[model samples]
Target: MPREVKKRGRRQEHKERKAKTTDHHQRSTKRLKTDHTADNGNALEVSGDAGDDFIGFDIAQPEGAHELQEETQFHGLLEPQEQEYYANVNNKIVANDFESAEDRATFIEAVHRETEGKELKVASSQSCSRYLEKIIMLSTPEQLRRLFSKFLGNLSYLVQHRFGSHCCEMLFLQAAKHVEKEHNKNASTNDDLASMENLFLQAAEELEPNMGFLLTERFASHIVRVLFLILSGESLDDDIVKAMLASKKKEKLDAPASKESELPENRRAVPKSFRTSLDRLIRSGVSTLDTTYLRALATHPTGNPVLQLLIQLELSASGKIKLSDENSVFHKLLPDPELEEDSESAKFIAGLIYDPTGSHLVETLVKQMPGKQFKKLYKNVLKSRLRSMSKNDTASYVAIRILERLGKDDLAEAKELIVPGLPILVSRRRTGLIKVLIERCAIRGVDLQDVADVIRSEYTKDDIDFLSALLDFKRNGVQDKTQKKGSESEKSAKSAHKTDVHGSLLAQAILQTSDICNLVQDSLLAVDVSTLTAMCQDSASSRVVQTALSPTEFNIQFRRHFVPRFYDQIATLAQDLTGSYVSDALWSATDGLHFMKQRLARDLANNESQLRDSPFGRNVWKNWAMDIYSRRPGEWQALAKGQERDQPQGGPQQNAPTGEKQKSAIELARERHAQKKSHSTNRKRNPATGANAAISTNA
Candidate 1:
């Protein structure tokens, strides 16, 4: 019978092997068809090696199949060991499963065997029993009190040495899952739920350190979801949630290394693990200790989205989440107090402010923090944040936005804050902010003219000198007479007698005439020409007009009275004014000759003829002639002689009267001749007759 059974077994094995080979061939055929379908529509067209036709059969069998089948046939041989292993695992998972010490020992031994000396660090059966007993026997208050204290201690330790905390976390997580299952089975009170939560928290404290290993978003998300469930007393595991929170807190406190470094050595860097963990914990809805969390987050080597979200949450909780409040958060995030003299935080902050979404927040912060302290802080932060921004134009744009917000209301404070760093900004061609700052300075009574000088000295190549001059002209009066005179002297010395090549003087003269009108029309015109040019080119005409018209009261008074009278005087001597030498000389000579000639011509023949011509005509003519002769007696003789010389060249007039008349005429003529001779001698002797004689000299 034994021989027959052995032969039968061999035949059955052969048959099974044949069946297996057939099954492999069928699978191979199906695979071929699938591949053929993928490639084209045809099948059974074999390619490559036919020798490998049986390779599929080798892959189909399970490894050690024969040995496993033999072991299964002798299952009773290891049933006790299997049962013991099962019982041990069950006891760790379920407190009431193990009834005695011997049972527990047997289960542990089986677990040891099954695990092959691998660490079988399972919860003790006794500990499980004790935990169940406490849950059943203790009041809710007692359980919570014990759980809280235990959790705090465990959490502290976990935070200190997080890498070794994973094993503890896993054990606690299992316990939490078990508790959750139990709670679901029996509906419990809120207080009982709280007690259960405390227990989970205690486990979480032990598990916190392991959280640092979670790198994936999904893992962090899972942890966070679990935490939220715990907080709300939902079906999710609490221990896992607590572990995530504790881990996140530890992460926030950890110092991170800067991203820019050359050396690569094994040293602790700010673990990305911590950030992921925190993100997960937050998503889980874990309650944070606000002040502490914020402080810790603020100290991060780099910014974190999670921390930013946390701040938003806290601010929102405090009812500070308006548009303005949102802006404040952005500003706060900006690097301030200059952590590094030149840091990237400033640039990052600048970029944030530049974002369309963030502009409102920036505006809000400026508005809310309108105090000197805030201004100083903000200025420092802004400077540092923009320090490393290669796109200074963008930075400048952000700064402009900040200034615009600040200038609209708190201009003085804004000016004070920005003026000190104007040089640095100007060097970068950050005109947007510079312009806003300049406007603010004007509003704040700052003399921006000097600002140009300051910036020029500091940022030599920057084209801000013109702006400075503009500001200066606006604040102080445009013209300093003393300075102008000095400048004129210097200019004159430089040019000597050379005519102005550019007609600049003529242009200035024309401009001067119209400049007053322009000034009266627009006060801004009172500024330097360069400023006016800038305004004309870059600013709106309406704005210039508005600025000009701002001093309406003063302009009205000046135009009405002072201007007209001043112009009338100018008109009176338009041709014979100080600028004309010929007119001046002619005017002086005419007046002097009148005085000298009137005195000598007082008794001439024409004077008598005018007295004898007619009573009225003679009297009138005699008075005019006598009046002229009275002023200049010497000029009358010279005039009479000139007339005699010009008369026809004849011997004498034969219409002579008596000796007395002729003697009188002769006496008059001789007297005229004697006076003329003397006057002629005086003229010849007078050095003033020479071309070299100074016109100013009186001979």
Candidate 2:
């Protein structure tokens, strides 16, 4: 389409659409007015009841809520001055990332005045809720304490209020240090200590009665976490403990009956929206838990993270706490036949081995626990179960790290643990884990036929090549930042020259198992040529193509064999926008890194005629020609003589097509000199011939 004609069509269409939209709006307004006139009498009849109730509820104001009937719209109606005040407070709270003391005070004073039972609910608009979370994070201790006073006086009332419940959660999280320090203060007398520890015990005791109400509360469930933190470790106060028990029951009851009915004993439960928040609550305050409470959380999706944190705490802090007592969570990991494989105690240890949330705990024991504890945990697992768990995504990540950690300590046991699981890891394409087992188990002299079988069956040749490229850079320590392949790693290099970051990073952290690099190189060399060629053309796998084709120490022999056999493809790769990267790597290998430079130089020198005719080949030739002419002038003269012998026009075309633009100033000057010499020779010959003819005529 002509540019101006196309633009005019678009402009005409836009005007027609705008006219239609305006007409639609006018029609809608007229319809609304017609409907309102018809309902005016009914609205007048209901206006009497609207003074105290709007839409059947009090204090139910929405940001811009309104009605055709005004009778029921007055529930949250405020004086003009009051509306202006809250609006200004909301703006100030939302404006500053780090609010000043003055802004905080203004927010607190405004909330304090209207902090009565249901008054704060009016401020729970979508915009208000969004900014309120930010203010909760920035609140000062003094402001929080005063704010807490407004709601804590009536805890149940606060629980029922929409926005008040959220405000209370912030007060509790920020007041944690204040309470903890108060509990440890230097008090000469009990009275001084109790006063310092006032809020901790007072809040806990006052809120204890309504624990179930708070736990099941849509916005108030987090309050239960705060009360639990105030009770320091090992001090299992029965009432507060009972409150926690009640909260768990509340979590169960809060679950919808339909979902509860849908799940069977063996099936996973439907996830709750609030589950992660409650899990984080448990994780943050897990230090205050006893073994009994820790056990309660072991099998829970969210609660399991709490037990994991407790295990980490126990291992890292031996002086401060005891964890192997009869009442302790880990006490069960010590083998006993009566504990049985399917028993709660055995299942608890098994959960850590395979559960996504629980695997890190298993990894901790493998990597950092005492030797005796490591043996106890490993022996407890059934080999079949270990195989089953290795196939899981999250579990496999930690499982590999565990294998390596154990391999370093006792190679024999690590092999036994890894060999059985290799098939599952390979079938699942858990390449990361398969690599660790390959490296760590190889040194232990364990046979890897089963693991190798899995890799062969599952991964394609390109995948194998990618793995080899990662292996090369990993061994070489030359990394590119574009490791990951998705949106999260968008900061990756855009240049075709750069390598993948995750592939490089994953390979970089590989154990110093040099034999594994050789094994991967052999596998790559053995990959089908057709498969390798297609892989080289792919953007995702091209980095691997570059590294594999380069003359690295690990792949030097293979590169020599591969490059000459497919010289045509190698030359084609030189000029391709994407494939050009591989050619660049070859140049770097021959000149820069000097990896078998003589072999590469000899190969190129023999292909001189081939390089002259191809575009990308000529690019490679120019680079080598510059180097030879600068430092090896004698060799340069011989190379020039050989290349210029059969030039198309009996002169060097310099790789340019036939055109006026193809001739340089030097070539043009040579042409002019040749023309002048020809003219002078012709003039001399003609004059001599004419003089001879005249002499003959006179005779």
Candidate 3:
């Protein structure tokens, strides 16, 4: 009984101990759980709390023990808030929820709140552009174009103000290309293109003034190209095409009325206001527009209709803008105030007329100005313009028309104008203008002498042929006028005197003209011998002749006179007889002697003429004639043989008989064979060699 009681007591005591330990452990667990929740909630609010103390007893940490514990607990607790914040922030930033300025501002404000001062970054322009691209991809073609137009509209202002005029121009160009591409893809999308066109037109209206500088000289051509594309229905709107056509038709219809009304002072004044406005615009920096653009406006059918109007206005204004007085009010208003011979604006104006498309403009200019003023202005502009042109390209078709117009009304002024401008044509070798000028001068009954004088003064000697022709026409005019004034009997005498005067003037002119030798040759070949011989004897001809013909003309004159007579005699002799060598030889000998006498007389005459002109006439004449005589063995031998046979020892040789004797019987026979051998040798040489030898030998 005692042993059982002891064992039971031990068991009871063990149970009691176990129950106490369990109760204490349960209390500690309850306290730790409550403490851990409180600590976690407050840890984030505490500075450097670490939250490690709140970690469960079962947890273990590595190197960043406190940090890892704090992060894990903090993240676990704040995961919902973080996710909610990020979601709201991303939605506000990326979503197109903002349609208006207010919405966009509000959304941006929210992003800033979410980011809490940590750099609030927004999408870049490129990003926005890419977003737009994606929208474009998903959108219909029309929708895409509309969006593009809207984007362009918004960007253009920014592009112009923020970037520059060039940027704005580029943007518009890009927009145009984009619209063009879309239009190309779907022809039916022209409506969309038309809408864009309207937008561009509106934009152009507002931006054109500011962007004027962007239209460089080359831009004119680009604009024209664009207009052409539009006009041809290649890439432009129908409205623009219709407008251009209507404008052109209106211009054509108005042209005749304008021309007719141009005669009246009040009617002519109508274009002044328009001209003033255009001049103002051009002077206000629009002149910087690329030459290409100007050319396009002038040439391209679809180019800006307004540009055409402006061109007309400019041309009209050019007519009104005159240099009348030293302090001319209207002239002062002109863009180029300096009346320089070579003004830039003048060149530009000339170029405007030079273009084939500017033909109408030139006609309009002529019509608008007073007849006299028009001639003067046209000449000035043309002269200035031609001077600016390339040597090879100076003779524009427009110049010809201007000259024709001038010739019709004011031939004298036209001649004066052509004098300066003629060199330009000459440099270009434009024979067409030359012929046209000559005809016009003739038709207008302009004094050929005056025209010739002007041409001679202005152009080089190489153009003397042209000048001489003009002079000939003038001389003929004088003769015609004189003949008209006199009776038939007196007409010849009067005409002869007039001819003499004209010939004298022409000779003087020819002598004074450059390259007199060449001029004489060309003139002699082209003009009548009567005219040439008269010119040769004229006092004015002395300048060129004296310089060119000191010794050579003496020989040349003799040759000139002798050769023709010799050929005439040879023809006569050849015609008279056929077979009979002895008779032919005797006849040839007689003819040869006659030729020698005639040549000697000519030489003597030429020497005499030279002597009369010079102080040492007699001696010079003797020396020259003797030199020529010595060169002819046939004549010299004949003279020696005839002298020996006629005078047994001594007798004075008479001039005529001596000349005949020089080429007498025997020497003439030898000369014929020698001449034949020389002819054979000449025939054996190449034609080119012979020609070269001839020129060289003559020189």
Candidate 4:
């Protein structure tokens, strides 16, 4: 059995590291001139000798790690009075208690006046830096320009400062939008101000020489990550990328908005120069560090994320020059196009497979490497290890990444390896690999029945048992039973919670495949009302229920049986945080069931006060359109019936009358109206040709 890697929150570990090293300053390294790219071409397949006996570099330190020496810069501390005033300002910003927009602007302006010329001091001060973040968070484009100009030359030093890094991160994030705006020549553009693009490019240049060093530095790594993202026109909203930039525990400053602005989902348009700068940044990383130090970065806690992003940006570059260039980061990491199993590069790949930090780099490599490299690696390495890799906690994520890139035939082979392990994977709550496999099968149009059959066999075709097993319902009960005392019990509870989440996610993923979702749908329909209601009230399982009722997933028959399970419990569900979402899903699920829609709506109406009292319930009420149902029920019913009606099949002829079918009163009235309008138009157009308007109208 592979040792389970203990996964804890890296954020707290990072904080402890910062506390230890914040006083230290890193010394610049003499750049190595050794070429890492090898031009060796050999037989494409791995040798049989490349098994467990081979030793790669030391897992602890691949190279001699450099220690950062403390370098002090004098930024005078804030006076007691100044500290108090800024603290007050921070409090106000946090509370956001301004009477009006103008008042808030005036207050911010006053604070800005006092903090002018002391930006560095304020940003570096632990007590006052949060205020600096808040200011940047709410700064106008012009104000941002002024602050950017002030911080331009000091970015090299400021980026590594513990408190100062937070300020810099926030500034870059806020200023990034302005750069996008300027690129599009929006209203935020100002001719008199320094261009955000130029300011950003200038900042990049200031840090360009240190870019390689920063990639491995604890604090500076995050700033460089954000800078590259902005320069490359990547969205900052990505969760993985965002997590790297800031801790979840970091205080959030909610800036008041005059109007909500949608961040671009796709890459924003960037200036031609920005792309050039991005290329230069990539080149700095590729050329600055030798292969050993770069490989060492694969496991460096602070550096691995930056390396992943660097790898991503390098491969994603449009010129495709890097893919062919032997000197590129891509080539340096894996010098052999065809990885021989016993080669150093192959060993390095193998070493990273189960190491927690290093495996992430493997994931990035699998995701972004060109098809040739991917196929070569897959053939040489990953193809043989899919089963064991999928079962290991650390390696399973890497497995997921590989599964995502496989073709249809490749996926079928992978299914062979992974499907047999589903029983073990479900037991371990390693459902991510399972989820990706099923999703890939769906996408690749491979038959899902193999995996579905495995599931059915494992859970023995009993719907509730299948669901309860997949949903990990027993774990929660076990957790409740176990949570009586010690640290061991707490650990059990946490583990159980993780199992619940993974199980719920797997269940939801299954529900998306209509053919294979039968087990889940049947289970949901057959489960008692109390059990169904309880599932909806819980957070993780609620998502499974919502996905089952999604418009595209299950049909009306499934929904008709499933939705009314909540008929007597609509009020109970609407009042819950998690259940409220299920209640909202009920509206979509009731499509084509007019009477059911009204009945559910009426239940919601009866509980109006209960819903109004709870925030979650109010959303359900609004989403259900209970107000319209109450005030104008006739119109509501018509709208509801129309919504529920099936789209006409074939054409108008299907709904058209057969022989002797009489039109309804409303239809006959509509015909008369059409005839009168036609007569009036004809009489008006041909009045001079002896057409009689009055006679035609009467007829």
Candidate 5:
């Protein structure tokens, strides 16, 4: 009973201890539950008493990270923002949301918002463009017409802006379409053109101080083209010019009118008819294109249309500026550049000559610029820059056109300009420029004596050289005549072979130009056949001889003199390799090809079989020209058709062949055969046989 009572006492104490331990735990659990419920699990569910302890475990990350990134890029454009913008646009388009002006305004605003940064967002642009295309296409004519004026105002900015360029192009096309639509209903183009012209005029006025920048702007260039198109009409101010000058905007829009200039300040003033279409509309005003406006577009990409438009305007014929006019004010337009300093006018033309786009402007200026303007361009700029300009392929074309238009006096002046650079142009093989210049001079009847004299002086007796030292000639417009002569020795002739090579190239080019061939021929005509024969035998000089004597060259009356005179030398020349080519040049001469054919045939008649067997004679007949001769083996004619028959006709039968001539031809052939046999026999004789060798030597 005592042990049981002790155990009971211990149990009672344990139970009291357990109750004490549970009391705090139950209170903490209840507090956490209460806290979690009140806060709605926004914070950690763990009680503050539990602190920040956590367990660690392995995490299984997502697979295909590379593929996920690649797949995320839309349309492969590589821009996420652009992709999103395009996607939004497509969604908006699908919903027919562009039907209302509000929708257009909203879309435009979105586009504007997206394009806020400096760099053009290509994606946003595409989206905006697509939206504009849809709106322009879906909108009614009334809607387009209403929006057209506002669009025109923003056109200058839109054309140059990257995102806006596409929209601007769409708008331009649509606006033109609307204009055409209005055209069918008794609508005057002037009304539509007036508004557009007014906008451009206003833009031009506002952008005047910054004309250079406006001209260069990618978008603003479109506005320039538009202005030019409006200017392409008959009268620019027929409708708007009445209010010009009085209303500044309208005046700027309308071109100045055609008027005669009486004052020095107004000498450069072109009549309204010669200016833009707007100019024709003005009744009494005048305007001129200044250096400032020209400077801006001289190098721009869209400069082609502007230049073409400028070139198309007529030059004022009745009252044009004369270069020789004592009181001319045109030169004053530019700051007078000193002799050492490049004139401003000169600088401008020179700049145009080198620019890729502006070079064409030089070409047009040559064709259309007045004599006074052209003279200034040539004397001040082009004359000094010929050497550099001649070498450039683009500039050379301009030089060609310029040469074609100049008078004899101007051409002679041009010759002096080229004299200093002639050798370099020759050495560098500027064939195109040389040919063009020579051709122009010949066709235009300019004296070739100056150039011919220069060439002759270079080909001295001792050495035919036009080296760098020789290239530097004084600009007196007269060639030196008293250079000491050297012996025409073999050494000198050999040295001249170098010049002969280039000379031949020059000659060939000269000969190909029909108009100039005669000039060159006349210049060198005094050279005798002995000199020509020596040249004709040479490897290089033969080309020159051939080209000069070619029948195909125009006005080649020289052929009649060449072929008939060289008739006896034909057989000898045809056998020489170089001479054979000279002989063949006759076959191709265009002037008197038939005369040459008859000449060759007549020579062939005299030496029938003998000539046929000759090496040089073999090349005279071309395979294509063979039909002109008979193929009969034994029916050799007395002479070629149209040629004088050397032998008299037989007594009773004029048409019959002469037996004596035939037998003589046969005997001559036999004699040649026997001679060939004897020669072969002599060569084959054994040298070891002394008696036979002595006999052969004696034979």
Candidate 6:
């Protein structure tokens, strides 16, 4: 080797910080810079008391001052054969082409047997760690508890390890649901295994000593956030925490996530012990780190997110009971409850509004802080800056969060400030703010005509282009090929190609409001048949078409005009994945138009082969019940009208053909009620004839 360069050790780095502090005292105006590169092992170490002097300003640190040695725990390595075997198992799970659920269960059980004593070993291996994650994701409660017991004493060390951190995070998330499940049933496994809730408590206790250190540790901070969510029984699917977790770039596994991972909840049922532990854990981090260190973490790359989550937990805990707690982290960040202007806390809040990392923390505070503090902060710091903030790249999101909590009067003021900049927002692709303003206006009974006018003015092209612009649809001539592609342009192109999820959402919100719903309905109705078909085929814009056809959003006249445009393309729509959804929407759209319904059925029948051959096509055919229409058109029409008989004149006692489904209870009740009403009407019509009829019958 030409030369071997060794990395600096922890002691050497600390000494360098002490030296910098002395030099900074000699020169007060010189600024130091901090490294923001993506490394998870570094602890947040501030250079001098210089940051403490400037209360609300950004405190930069030198490059080497914040480095913490990444400690790798040496779990025993695997043999060649073991590595190959585990890799194969990983591929099998990733493929997930099982015949049935039972088969997958059997395969998992076999995997458990092979990796029984080597859980930690597999977890620490870079190549094998993902296999462990898949195993935990698919593990039963009993198996999860077994792994939890195996990693009992080693958690603090494992959390700092690069690969082991992922395993620990997965284990905690997957095991959290079991605690609630056992608590709800008031039972545990009928074996020697400890209760999952108790196991969770013990795991927290194991990491208690290292709480403060882990909060700033690169890999450990992520695990700490997950642990806090588990203790609080907060949903892991929250958008705030989801954004924080995605800060680190890692390859997402293709394995199926659990139900708890998919379904979101406001909160889950954690144990009383978990609550106590949560309180202690929160206190441990606050008490261990002094005010200076905690404040420094406000802008620290890895620490900022964890700090945001902690502050939210503190504010939201026990119905905001902890809001005034003296030792609370939120209290430490802003000691003044009033947040007076020119105060250090106020300056801090102002600085965070525009920072890339600190703004996220500001958002969490805006959402969870007490109402009095929010009112004071908004009046003193944010009220005059609404227009400027909404136009900023990073601060615009913070502005959106503030809008979510504003009162009707405040929202109207915000609307006035933001409406003037609609053109600027559109130019910067900050349509999210526009969408939120529209929603709040509708909710607060503010005038929506202003927003409608802005939209109409900006997209002054024809109706097709208006709808296309709202949906962010790109046409061939919209942009010249010679235009330089920046980062923003690339992002827009990618989003547009994938159907622009946010654009679709904006269109749906606009259609929900009656004041401006016609803007979209009129545009959709005015499009040519080919463009209409293209919108129906798209994954995102197709939803807008369905909403427009819905009776809640549009009247029958609109649907009558909209439904015919698809009649010629019914076969094409039925065969497409996205277009199939539009085809289903047509079924409900033609609710009372019997002629349109008949025409639709005739078109579907003509394309029966094409519909039956494709997968999405098959789903459309089944949903429309085309088989019944082909065999018995009369019964199909009767059933469509909520009747069970083949003919409308048949009594309730008359059943359909054999092997047909039975009538629902509501249908039977309706028929019985109609029969009674008809009998009484006949008797009322001819009383003398009814008496003569009865006398003849008795004779």
Give me the candidate number with maximum lDDT: 6
For candidate 3, the C-alpha RMSD (Å) to the true structure equals: 37.8
State the local distance difference test value for candidate 4: 0.75
Alpha carbon lDDT at 286, candidate 2: 32
lDDT of 5: 0.47
- Whole-model Cα lDDT per candidate? 0.35, 0.47, 0.39, 0.75, 0.47, 0.77
Model 6 CA deviation exceeding 4 Å by range: 1-73, 95-117, 184-187, 246-248, 254-266, 461-464, 472-501, 639-699
List the candidates ranked by lDDT, beginning with the highest.
Answer: 6, 4, 5, 2, 3, 1
Over 1-699, each residue of candidate 6 has an lDDT whose tens digit, in order, gives 587875679998888889998787666544433363234443343434423322221223222223233353476999999999989998888888889877887888889889998988898899999888998888888888888999898887788888999999888888886787799888887568878988889988877755766777767888998899899888877775787764747667667654654434567888888989988777766675556678788888878988888888777775356667778788788887778788888888889889998998999889997888889989988888889999999899999998998999999898888888888876565679888888888888888898888887777545446777777766542232113234457545534454566777778888888789888888887777876776777778889988887666347777778788888688788888888888887776776776786788789899989888989888777667678788878877875554554322321222245676655557766887999999888775544468788897787
**How close is each model in CA RMSD to the real structure?**
42.0, 24.5, 37.8, 12.4, 29.8, 10.4
| Cα-based TM-score, every candidate | 0.22, 0.42, 0.24, 0.76, 0.35, 0.77
Regions more than 4 Å wrong, model 4? 1-70, 183-193, 246-253, 257-263, 460-464, 474-499, 601-622, 626-633, 643-699
Q: Which of 2 and 4 is the better model by TM-score?
A: 4
Off by over 4 Å in 5: 1-158, 161-214, 226-230, 233-367, 376-402, 449-509, 512-699
Instruction: For model 5, give the 10-residue run with minimal summed lDDT.
Output: 53-62
lDDT of 4 at 9: 98
RMSD of 5: 29.8
- Model 3 misplacement above 4 A: 1-200, 217-221, 224-310, 316-402, 407-409, 416-428, 435-699
Give the per-residue lDDT digits (tens) of candidate 4, residues 1-699: 999885489987888789766443221122223233233322222223323422222223213333222336667898899899999888888888899988987888888888898899999998899878877777777888889989987887788888898899888888887676776774445677688888998998877765666676667778988898888877778887677666577677675644523356677777889889987877765575568867877887777787788788778865367777877877787777679887888889999999998998998889888888789899888889988998998999999999999999999998988887888975666678888888889989989988888877777545446777777665355435234324556545534553378778878888888779887888787666766776776678889998988867356678877777778788888887778888877776776777787888888888889889999887777667567677867756765665422212211122234564544547655776998999988874545324576667667
TM-score of 5: 0.35
Q: What is the clash count for each candidate, in the order shown?
A: 26, 5, 17, 2, 14, 2
Single out the weakest 10-residue window by summed lDDT for candidate 6: 646-655
Q: Which number leads on TM-score?
A: 6
Q: Measured by C-alpha RMSD in angstroms, how accurate is candidate 2?
A: 24.5
lDDT of 1 at 322: 26
- The TM-score-based order of candidates, best leading, equals 6, 4, 2, 5, 3, 1
Candidate 1: give its CA RMSD in angstroms. 42.0
